[model samples]
Target: MQEFKEREKQEQTISSPLSESLYENLRRIRTVFQTSHDVVIRELRIGEDKNIPIVIVYTDGLASSQSVSGFILDALLVHTPKVEGVHNPEKLFELMSTSILAGGEVKPLSDFEKLYLAVLAGETVVLLDGCAKALMVSTRGWKDRGVQEPTVQTVIRGPREAFSESLRTNTALVRRRVKDENLHCEQQAIGRITKTDIAVMYIEGIANEKIVKELFERLERIDTDGILESGYIEEFIQDSYLTPFPLTYNTERPDVVAGGLLEGRVAILVDGTPFALLVPVLFGQFFQSAEDYYQRSMIATAIRLLRYVCFFIALLAPSLYIAATTFHQEMLPTQLLISLASQREGIPFPAFVEALIMELTFEILREAGIRMPRPMGQAISIVGALVVGQAAVEAGFVSAAMVIVVSITAISTFVFPSYEMAIPIRVLRFLMMLLAASFGLFGITMGLLGMVLHLCSLRSFGAPYMAPFSPIRLAGQKDMIFRLPHWSLRKRPAMISKENPVRDATPAPAPPRPEGEQS
Candidate 1:
């Protein structure tokens, strides 16, 4: 069996090393990227009579061609100055890196794994004829989306700029907003094949050290073959995978992420996706928006209250209808009850069946509206509204009251400021409907209790998920469910920002007294 194994072909291990022989290293690199046509390895001779053999390796589309030509290739080949005397190839590498290279960024690499990573991350690598160390040149330039208005989590009053797919651009967006020297970004390359870039951002003194340490440990534990987007890392590192509620908040708006960082939350940014994930996400956070801080405190507070009301309405509207119509008719007003009964006169379905049908149909329509082409998506909405609102009732398939309930639930769901929060609520809404259908109002109450318990039991990066509500931390309630004036906000969240708790100085602001004679 051992002899047979020796005869069989083996895969190239990542531990493979470069050799002093120029041809040997070239053969190894080519063998590893055998089928990849995008790999470009250019060989040239330079230095002191153009006798030195050097090779530059980079991916064709990933590295900027203009940079390679203008900064690297021209400097090494055409404009290279002649040295007085020749030396060992190792010394030649030193001379070329220090004296000959004109690239903006240059670093030396001795390990093959790091060299490979640098090249794959859109950099250029230079190898000498008789040297083991390679020079990694920063030539990253690829066509990516420019900073544009955020499609999701948009704000009407705040800055319109949004994060792009590139990791550096996204981090820069946050940096531009915060402009604090204490803001730090730690990077890690995840995934075995994809090697996606992940940046952990937090305020150095404000962010909880325990949470940052735990976050790094969890990220290091991920052993996946590939991570395509932020959602991939999100699922791998979240508190609980079984719970329906999201333990992390994700957004495409950089201002929102910067605000979260200021509040002592850590932000995780993944390569190739615009959305950045924030940890220690509280239940009240989903109802808050970046626009809240831009507007007057009173207006923001009223809107925030409306959002909380809408959340309950979306979560319990269908279930309440099912329970009241199926088991407890006395809870509803008689006039409303008579109107609903009159609408359900010809419908043969029970309250539970009717709710389930309408809710499921609306979900299907919602999916269709989002998945279809943009022009067709709008058409899907029109068709869905007509079919669900008028056609279904006229066809005697569902009662008008049932359609109205489902419509209200769907509209209320849109009131949530964050779609990630709405996702769990959407799935839980169906579960709540089922419980109410089975046990009426008691079952609904039991479902609500279980949800609260689950939320209380959950934690986000070692901090409470239902913070300021379950444990009743009064200090953290300044901005919960209402917007206090920024000057009145005197402290950071005690749960997360333990090190430097005070956010503002003493002597809170007050309305100025009119000019009067003072004693």
Candidate 2:
């Protein structure tokens, strides 16, 4: 028994050296980054005679400089008198907790993994020689863009404040709207190299837990080196990698994110990006906006209907023109057909070729207008309209009717609230044009059918993308194509309502009239 005990003691001693060496090696490996602003090391002598040296290390950018200077540095170097026993890591942590100057907890550096995490969180670390643990001080300060009005999603009557680049700031913006305690935000660090912090927020009781779980699972599977923008994360986690249509919806407005959460959806907010991702998005969701809810129901409905009309115009105008002129001439009114034929009398190219030429030119000009500086953008648009429309007609390059159709189509595409949603329509416009030229109205019908079928097949987190239309949920029809009065919208969307059936407690009764009033 005595011999066994000695052998056990020797084994422990042998392992102790390796552990110590491992810790030392890790510390050295961390320093190799040689990032000047990061990896700051501070040496402190607590007392005049204690002879105890304290080394503080932290990534400069990740930590608050003011807090470190005013609290940790001021307290350790100037306020407290150095004592021999105060050199220990536990003692340091306890001292910090009690001292008003520190304002945060101090942890052991021997918890080196946590030390690295602390550095990432903008905390400073203090290392004491001959001590098993290191003292980590909270001091993280970084500058970020202030919340401002969303440039892209401007509203005439709604909250002007938009989400900022900071995840915490963005989440807080959302939290301000929803004061419910059930609103939960889960944080995860994504990107192997950038270590970007991504936050997933949703209402616990209202949001679909299964959908949220799937969203998180897919996010965890992303194995990228860096997430420089929200687009990077969006493209990584989207359901259909090949589709031009965006599977995930993104917005810069905090109200939109909050609204999605209320509708039992999960929102992903990425650090350093203003755009927030909303999951389980349907085709119709892209058409709706915060403005839609804020405006009068009648006006909102009219606008939504107009947008729906615009979508068709954008997709079918050019194609319909090509079909009517090239293959379906007999279907057009005699006078209209005669006018169109007269306009194209001198045109050298076929109806399809003329339409393609005008469309390509318009697309190029549109792209140029967007890419150019703001001051020059308006000028480009004006010049493009006058030169492309008027000049092409006079030159006999394209028919006047074709020019009108293309212009209307281009204008209609702009009505879509979501830019991502509009992009697929733009691509589909060309395909429909080709089909119409080849097979007339029948081809257009087939193309529309194919699109509908594709949309029906798409599942946004297991909910039918074309819900309340394809599956035909009558309960959700109130809010599908038009905005119904708030009081009349008794039931929530059936797709998400499985998780949250009761949107309101009871129907609000009409206000009572005066006693003298008669029906």
Candidate 3:
């Protein structure tokens, strides 16, 4: 922490305009970049006499070598000698910017802060002998993971391309999908030291102005040393920090971001991370997937409803089993009760302790599977669970029924389309189990009510977290738990696109009228 403050102070002290003297400028540059072996400073002489002094400063391996050799160096050394009136430093700088370095994107930079930003961002900076301003040319060419298939959010029918680590590449992917003049991408530098680039994207007229303004205000208020991923920005800008539920949605797919922008939601794309963040997320949004739109409406609706059912099963399965066996034994059938009693005759722990043991074991296996190598992960999780559960059942540690309940709950948790939403469910399941252990069915009911009330009270960028359910918007319901036919979804969700509510106007399809029937 103290090092960060010292670095900040050093940067502040050097934030001044560049000098016209070439030697003095070189001294200051060397002072700032002392001991940085990768900082390449190439001195060159331009013009007919070959005495016009200039220095090229860039970081090796960041700025493309081919571009520097072919376009910049060749232009200054070979092409400028034939031109006339090149002795004056101001005229030389103008000629080089306008006619010499014609192949590259060049910008005039005056202050040291701007110069350092351009150079560190993989661009070449040229300082003339007697000119106050320097030329910054874009030549970034670092190794990157080219566009690859989605890993976490895999979809069978949607586009196979996903966002890459490069900010420009990610933006271009979205641009390719949403080709509209109103698709606005505003860029800003976040992180005091990292200077990580972030783009705030939304449609101009379709997005709510208030939401956009608020988002900008929140981003501007963030003060940090470094932003490693979109998650950092999400944490800094989220409405509440106490809740486990994620207020912002993140995805690696560009189609998801493009879809969000069309719905008037803002997207934040951070550099050095593939995941992009969508703001003002709702509870229902996590249940819907990109495949929901690709498939037929009825099938999508059925799948979406199944996800909601799975959500409850994942949340309440263990708690219900604990409650039934410990407090409400009469709820079970007589025959089943006898079998369960026979199985638990020799067990030492009570129902709650038994369930907690199995739950913790399963959770440990799940995390191990994720952290281990891919080939061993699946094998370890599957084989370990089967062996441990069987041994425990045979040794009178837990009943077979408990193993079945835990397995079902684990499977249901994997059914969620958004993993962020599933995480909160996993956490709440433990709380629900505790409630059921203490108060049985009544405690479970009270927990449900409290969870629903909390969801209703939560807000994502001032939009209701449980929108269209707590607020009960009829228009938004068409695409909530049940995705209606495409033609029926003619308007965007409330508060998202109030500026331009209507999205689609096409009516439902019908067979063409046969042979001129009389009206």
- In terms of lDDT, the poorest run of 10 residues in model 2 is 13-22
Model 2 per-residue lDDT tens digits across residues 106-147: 645555455566667777776655555656676766888789
Q: Which parts of model 2 have CA positions greater than 4 angstroms off?
A: 1-30, 35-39, 48-50, 85-89, 97-101, 104-114, 509-511, 517-519
- After superposition of all CA atoms, the RMSD between model 1 and the true structure is 2.2
Per-residue lDDT tens digits for candidate 1, residues 336-361, read 99998998898988988988888888
Worst 10 residues of 1 by lDDT: 6-15
Better of 1 and 2 by lDDT: 1
The candidate maximizing lDDT is: 3
List the global CA lDDT of all models.
Answer: 0.87, 0.80, 0.91
Ranked candidates, highest lDDT first: 3, 1, 2
lDDT (Cα, 0-100) at 268 in candidate 2: 91
TM-score of each: 0.95, 0.90, 0.97
lDDT of 3 by residue, 452-472 (tens): 999999999889999899888
